[model samples]
Target chain A: GAGVSQSPSNKVTEKGKDVELRCDPISGHTALYWYRQSLGQGLEFLIYFQGNSAPDKSGLPSDRFSAERTGGSVSTLTIQRTQQEDSAVYLCASSLGRANYEQYFGPGTRLTVT
Target chain B: AQTVTQSQPEMSVQEAETVTLSCTYDTSESDYYLFWYKQPPSRQMILVIRQEAYKQQNATENRFSVNFQKAAKSFSLKISDSQLGDAAMYFCASKGPSGTYKYIFGTGTRLKVLA
Candidate 1:
């Protein structure tokens, strides 16, 4: 539990169903990031939250994808009407605000949409 | 936009032997950072080594070291005395120290240690 913790290590859901993934960042870390890693593909940035000063949602793939961080700690990524293509390993990472600081990552949530 | 590229999809090395994983990136920024991360079966993203653009000296961490060529925009990870425990997927990433600080990762190279 010293590292970033993610909930629902694995999730299997049907298409058109909604799913929510959670992330608990390391204590005192102010920056949290979301990324998706599809099979054979590099990790894709999703969203970024830094001390709750308006999250950088620029990486959200579509309007249906959104995320929020409360208390500058725990965060959730929601996917509405999920599609098969949305299946991937959702990774959460946290880092100190200082640039060049290493980012600590969670085990990630494996999502499968059928 | 910044991009990282790992040309090798897979690589193998005999136990105790040395191996190198190649990585390249495209970035116009003059200042930034490059990193190599290892993901074992446990799925933890561990930082193997890092190099700063401003520093001309390379970085070494135990059995892991990096060969950073700033002008060529290449950062390669060299593993010495490879161990079976070293078998994992290694990712090369880059991020500008300023601005968004969003890391751009490569596809990764799957490393295997033959015992």
Candidate 2:
């Protein structure tokens, strides 16, 4: 089976610029999630989508961060006006559903705000 | 809100030895799931083991096992006969029951295997 995949393994951008990270979840996966991991820090939850229900944006750090899951298969995380503090590895994961199932993670996109 | 904690920043164990990584979480929900994820230098997260709060028996996979104490809110991973490939960052995570399946992860513990 194909695993979760992310694009632009490494991204370098200037401060205040916007960046869009893409994620392709496994086939038939109905749950997708985005998280950020800073150096020496834990994985910070960003957003989550379950089936066609409303996406959970409670973990979004700010309004500048947003995500959209199109057709319930792919998801894109956009960071508008990125700041230096936003430099980290953006990870995406997908699951079959809820039900305490294991979440498969992608390689992640390392965003560097210079 | 739920929180996961890994008290050890790093740990080292010799090959073929045993090592345990400690994890604790704070959550009001009684029924949830605890997981141990391993991230190697390649930066890919892999599911190591999982324990359901409702089950009293611990979860074990090959040489990897978990000592889950629901009452104390503690979940520790024990690796017996550790191998070099086991060297990686171990993270403890918790997923609340139903609703959104977002995972709350710990700070992670770096494990080093020595020959």
Candidate 3:
């Protein structure tokens, strides 16, 4: 419970279905980030939320992939019309939002699209 | 655009021996930081080591150390006293002064420790 936590450690969904993955960052950590780890693509940044500032969605692959952090704490990543390629380990991390601060990660959610 | 590259796709080391995983990057920011993370079959991304570009000294965490060459834009992870637990996928990442502070990660190198 001390480190970042995620719900539904494993998720299996059918193609064209929608799935929402949740993440709860460490308390007082203002910077929260989402990353996807695929077989060959390695770790890819998905989105980041820092304090109350606007989230940087530049890493999002498409409009179908979106995320939002509420109350600057819990966040959810939603994939609409999930495809087989959307299957991957979704990781969540939290940092102090300061310069050169290291990120603390959670046990990622394994997503499988059939 | 910031990019990170890992030329070594796989590496192997005998137990108690040493191994090095190579990484390179291209960034326009004057100030940046580099990090190494390990992901095992468990799928947890654990931070291994971090090196700041401003520091000339490389970072060392017990058996895990890094060779940081700022001029060459190279960051390599060196694992000493390799153990079975050290077998995992190592990723080299860089975060520039791009306001968002998003990391650019390499394709990663799979390291296997032999008994």
Top DockQ model: 2
* Residue-wise C-alpha lDDT for candidate 3, range B1-115, written one tens digit per residue: 8999999999999999999999999998888889999988787789999988888999999999999988898999999999999999999998886354788889999999999
True contacts kept of each: 0.56, 0.83, 0.68
What docking grade does candidate 2 earn? medium
Which runs in model 3 stand beyond 4 Å of their true positions?
B98-100
Better candidate number, 2 or 3, judged by DockQ = 2
Q: Which pairs clash in the backbone of model 2?
A: none
Per-residue alpha-carbon lDDT of model 2 for A24-106, expressed as tens digits?
99999999999999999999999989999999899999999999999999999999999999999999999988664789999
Q: Please give, for residues B1-115, the per-residue lDDT of candidate 1 as tens digits.
A: 8999999999999999999999999998898999999998777788888888999999999999899998899999999999999999999999886655689999999999999
Candidate 3 backbone collisions, by pair:
none
Docking class of 1: medium
lDDT of 3 at A35: 95
For each candidate in turn, give its C-alpha RMSD to the true structure in angstroms: 1.0, 1.0, 1.4
Top lDDT prediction, candidate number: 2
TM-score, prediction 3:
0.96
